[model samples]
Structures are given as C-alpha cells and as structure tokens.
Target: MRKKLIEAIKAAFLSEGYGFFQGFADKIQGSELTLPALWLTPIEVAGMSGRNDGKVTYKIVLYLFVQNEQYDEQQKEEKWEELERIARKGIATLPMISDVISTDKVTIKPDEFAFTSFGELSQTVTFLADVYFCNE
Candidate 1:
C-alpha cells in the first residue's frame, strides 16, 4: 500500500513534466550518498485520487533525497528549497488539476522525512491539494 502511494506520487510528478526518480536501498550500501545510483523515473503523466463525499479528489506529495554525508547542513537546506521550487514550477506549468482541492509543500529534517509512511504522506498530499483546489 505504501509502495503504491509512492508510485502514485511519482506518477503525478511525471505527469507534471518533472522527472520522477527513485533510488533503491541496495545500490546505496557502500557507495557515497553523493550521487543517486538506483533511480526510477516515471514515463507518464498520471494522478492519484480518492473518493470522498461523492467526489473524486486528486493530490500528490514527493520525498526528495540528498545524501547528508555529501552536503553540509546549509547545502541540504538549499537543496530541499530548490527541489520544492522546482516541483512547484513543474506543477504550475502543467494543466491545472480541476479536481484538486488544495496543495501543500513541507520540509523536514532528513531523519523525519525518512520516518514518514507513504500512506501518511499521501494523506498530506490529499489534504493540501483538496483544501486549496476544491471549490465548495
């Protein structure tokens, strides 16, 4: 289920024209975290939605990773900001999600980000987009 949510978000990002990439844990075992070794990029534009109150709601959230060992604290912060900006730009360039209610952007320490579940993350996406995108 968690994997599915991650994939859904990745798909959403791809649909928005941003490259959705994933790096598997196995490939990061010994190599420096400086560069991503196992990355998965989505090939299509897609949206994930759930039905609520007789309506379909679409939303997405993404977890971007940067190697802490390779970047200083300031660099990590900058990278996150940059990534978020890029994500927003990507979304802005794409066709609007007529079904979305709202959207949100969150930044957390790497450890906190690592501990979040895919479902929880997905819920955040739903809430953010729904609150803003949905027109009551």
Candidate 2:
C-alpha cells in the first residue's frame, strides 16, 4: 500500500516535469531546491464525526519530511499548498467505491493535511490507497 502511494506520488511528480526521482539518482531535486532524503512519513487513518449530519468519516494523513532548512516558512507553505492540490487531484481521479463513500481534504494544522473518506468502505479504501500510492 505504501509502495503504491509513493509510486503514484512519484509518477505525479514526474508527470508534472519535476523529475526529482530520476534526476538526482540518490536525492530529491525540487525545481527550486534539493534534499538528500525527502522522507515520506507513515500514513495514518482515523474515524471522525461529519459536518453535514450525525455521521462518521475516515481520515487519512500522509506526511512528507522536507528538510528543515530547505525552504523558508513562506516557501514551505506554498509548497505544501501545491502538494495538497496535487494530492487532491490524484484522489479525485480514482474511481468511486460506493455511493455513500466520499473523499475530501482536511486541515489538521498549518503543516498537516489529510484526505478524508466518509462511509463504510472509506477506511478500507483510504488505507489501501495510502499504502499503495506511498509504496508503489
């Protein structure tokens, strides 16, 4: 699962012409920066109450470790927003699993973002997708 998620991310980056995986050989070379190890932290999932009504939603958190000094606060924020957009776009392209299940982006904090799923199959697919994309 992690492999798939990673692969998907790498593919997305490559598709966007970043080529970080291919250019550096052993490092991640962003368009305006570079890093030795751009660590993608473990993925996490949780269930929470929904806003529309009395319901539950599944949330998945995926983390990426950009070196502390690589980018300034403003740059980091901009990069985060870009990455979030990319992630959301990628998830939107995935086929629907069930009528009741839906996904959306959630903000955990200034530096943390989550892709949330609502409904019965939400947890299962979200977990599988996180692993799949992160690992592939």
**lDDT value for model 1:** 0.38
For residue 131, model 1's alpha carbon misses the true position, in angstroms, by 12
lDDT of 2 by residue, 81-106 (tens): 65555545545543232222445554
Q: Score candidate 1 by TM-score against the native.
A: 0.38
Report the C-alpha displacement of residue 110, candidate 2, in angstroms: 4.1
Candidate models: Cα lDDT each: 0.38, 0.37
The candidate that wins on TM-score is: 1
